[model samples]
Structures are given as C-alpha cells and as structure tokens.
Target: MDSEVRSYRTGGDEVVLDLTRDAADFVSGRGDGLLQVFVPHATAGIAVIETGAGSDDDLLAALGDLLPADDRWRHRHGSAGHGRSHVMPAIVPPHCTVPVLGGTLALGTWQSICLVDLNVDNAERQVRWSFLAA
Candidate 1:
C-alpha cells in the first residue's frame, strides 16, 4: 500500500473543493487497485458527486436545510452552527474508496471527488490518500 497526506486550504467558509485531479495524479501509473480517500476531521467529509453544474451548491443547500447551523445544537464551540459540521460526516461520510483500473479512476464522466468542509473555524485540512494494489 502507498499512502500520503495532502493539505488543502478551504478558507473560513463552507466549500466543496474538487480533488479528482489530485487523486488521479496520486494513482497514476499505479495499476489496478483501490484508492482510499480519508479526511481525519470531524467537520469534514469526502464526497463523490457531479461538480460545476450547481450540484455542489445544491449539496450545501440541502445540508443547510437538513442540519441548520444554529444554537439548537449541543456541540457548540466554534462559529454559529459549528455543531452542524460535526454532524455532516454522518451524511457525507469522512472517507470514500474509489476503484482504479489500469491506472485510471473508474468514475463516471460527470463524477468528481470533492472535499466538503463546513467548519469555518479551521482554514486548513488534511486528506489521507492510500492506494492498495489489487
């Protein structure tokens, strides 16, 4: 297995940063295997979805409706609705495994790997990428 952690600056706002390119680069020439993308944070998650077609924003909006960042949460500490960040992982999940075939990601044409960060307190995030050859 080959593994590495990469840093990303998500700023102090909620965002869905695309990571397909990075993941592809990491698995390039590595042959058939599985790529595991993990975010070691309570407030962050990894998602495989279509991007650039408002799907990203729609996801955030859906989450906002589902888990409104308000004072109703008991896990308060950071910004308003910070507690919602912790709950996001339940829906989005903190890790995802993608199949790589012939050194290429076996994802749909419109699909993309994205980092979903709802925590406004931290501007930096680390994603661990591990590849296991088949």
Candidate 2:
C-alpha cells in the first residue's frame, strides 16, 4: 500500500490523477488482485473515466449542477463556503478497486483515474492507494 497527497488550488475543479502504478506495488508484481483507490476526505471523490473529449469539463459541469457551490450548506457554518461538496462525496464511492493481471491495472485503453475536488480551498488531499494481490 502507498499513499500520496494531491493538492488542489481551486474550488469546483477537476483534475486527472494518473495511477499507472496502482497495481505494480502489490508486492508480487504478478497476480489476481484488487486495486483500491481511496480519497480520504469529505469533499472529494475518485473516478475512473476517459481522459479526453471534454470529459473532465463535462464532469465538472455536472457536479456543479448537482451540487452547486453557490448554495449555502450547513457546513458553511465553518470557514468553507460550500457544503454540497461534502454531500456529493457521500454518494460517490471514494474507494475504487480494479482487477489486476500481470501486475497492471487492467483498465480500458483510454480509461484513466481521476480525482474531483469540490472544496473551496487550496490544500493537500490524501489519496490512499492499496492493492490486494491474490
């Protein structure tokens, strides 16, 4: 298992998180396994999607529509102005596991790992990467 931090500088933003080695570190370098990607935060989420064709922009727009940042959420009680970000995470699966073969994340040729940061702060995000090799 390995963990890394992705720091975002904007609210309502989308970024491509490349996880090329998620399956490689599974200790055996070869086996049947699960690649678990976790976003340990209340206002962020992880997803596997195609990296192009304006997919990132489309998701950003969709999330904004679903959880508009301008809305006043109870979490706004704190310094953060938006609360829907947190709400969104609750519904989105923070942990994503993929089948591994030959020690590689066997995703589609165009598929990519991504992180959606919905908070209004420039800070560090903890992304926990784990693998269960068989």
Candidate 3:
C-alpha cells in the first residue's frame, strides 16, 4: 500500500474544496488500484459531488437546514452549534474509496472529490490518500 497525507488551510468558513486535481497528481504513473481519501478531522468529511453548478452551494444550504449552526447543540465549545460540524461526518462520512484505473480516478463527468468543512475554529485540515495495488 502506498499512502500520502496532504494538508490545507481552510480558513474560517464553511467550504467545499475540490480535490480531484490533487488525487490525480498523487496517483500519477500508478496502475490500477483503490484510492482511499480520508479526512483526519471530526469536524470535516469527504464527499463526491457535482461542483461549480450550484450543487456545492445547494449542499451547504441543505446542511444548514439539516444541521443548523446555532446554539442548539450540547457539544458546544467553539462557535455556536460547532457540535454540528462533528455530526457532519455521520451524514457526509469522513472517507471515500474510488477506483483508480491506469492512474486515473474513475469518477463520473460531474462527480468530484471535495473536502466538506464547517468548523470555524480550526483552519487546518489533513487528508490522507492511500492506494492499495490491485
């Protein structure tokens, strides 16, 4: 198994950062295998979604509706409703495994790997990419 961990500064805002290019770069020159993308943060998650078509915004809106960032959570610490960020992984999940053929990710035309972060207290995030040869 080959693996690498990448870190990024997400700033203090909710975002859906695209990571397709990074994944491609990591698997460059590699062969068929499974690409596992995992986030080592409880307040963040990994998601495969259609981006740049308002889908990202729609996702954030849906999350807001489902997990409003208000003072209604018991796990209060950082920002109000920061606990919702921890609960995000339950719905979006913290990892995703995609098929890599000929060193390329087998994702759909609009599907993109993104880092979903809602935590306003932390600005740094790490994503681990592990490839298991087939």
Q: Which candidate number has the best lDDT? A: 1
Per-residue CA lDDT of model 3 for 1-134, tens digit only, reads: 99989998999999999999999898877899999999999999999999999999999999999999999998999998899998999999999999999989999999999999999899999999999989
Q: Candidate 2 — worst ten consecutive residues by lDDT sum? A: 5-14
Off by over 4 Å in 3: none
User: Model 2 over residues 66-115: C-alpha lDDT tens digits?
Assistant: 77766477777433546776787765567777787777778888777777
Question: Could you tell me the lDDT of residue 79 within candidate 3?
Answer: 92
Residue 47 local lDDT, model 2: 78
RMSD in Å for model 2: 3.4
Candidates sorted by lDDT, descending order? 1, 3, 2
Candidate 2 local lDDT, residue 133: 59
TM-score attained by model 1 = 0.99
The better candidate by TM-score, 2 or 3, is 3
- The worst-scoring run of ten residues by lDDT in candidate 1 lies at 69-78
Model 1, clash count?
1
Pick the winner on lDDT between candidates 2 and 3: 3
Each candidate's root-mean-square deviation in Å?
A: 0.5, 3.4, 0.6
Report the error of model 1 at residue 95, Å.
Answer: 0.5
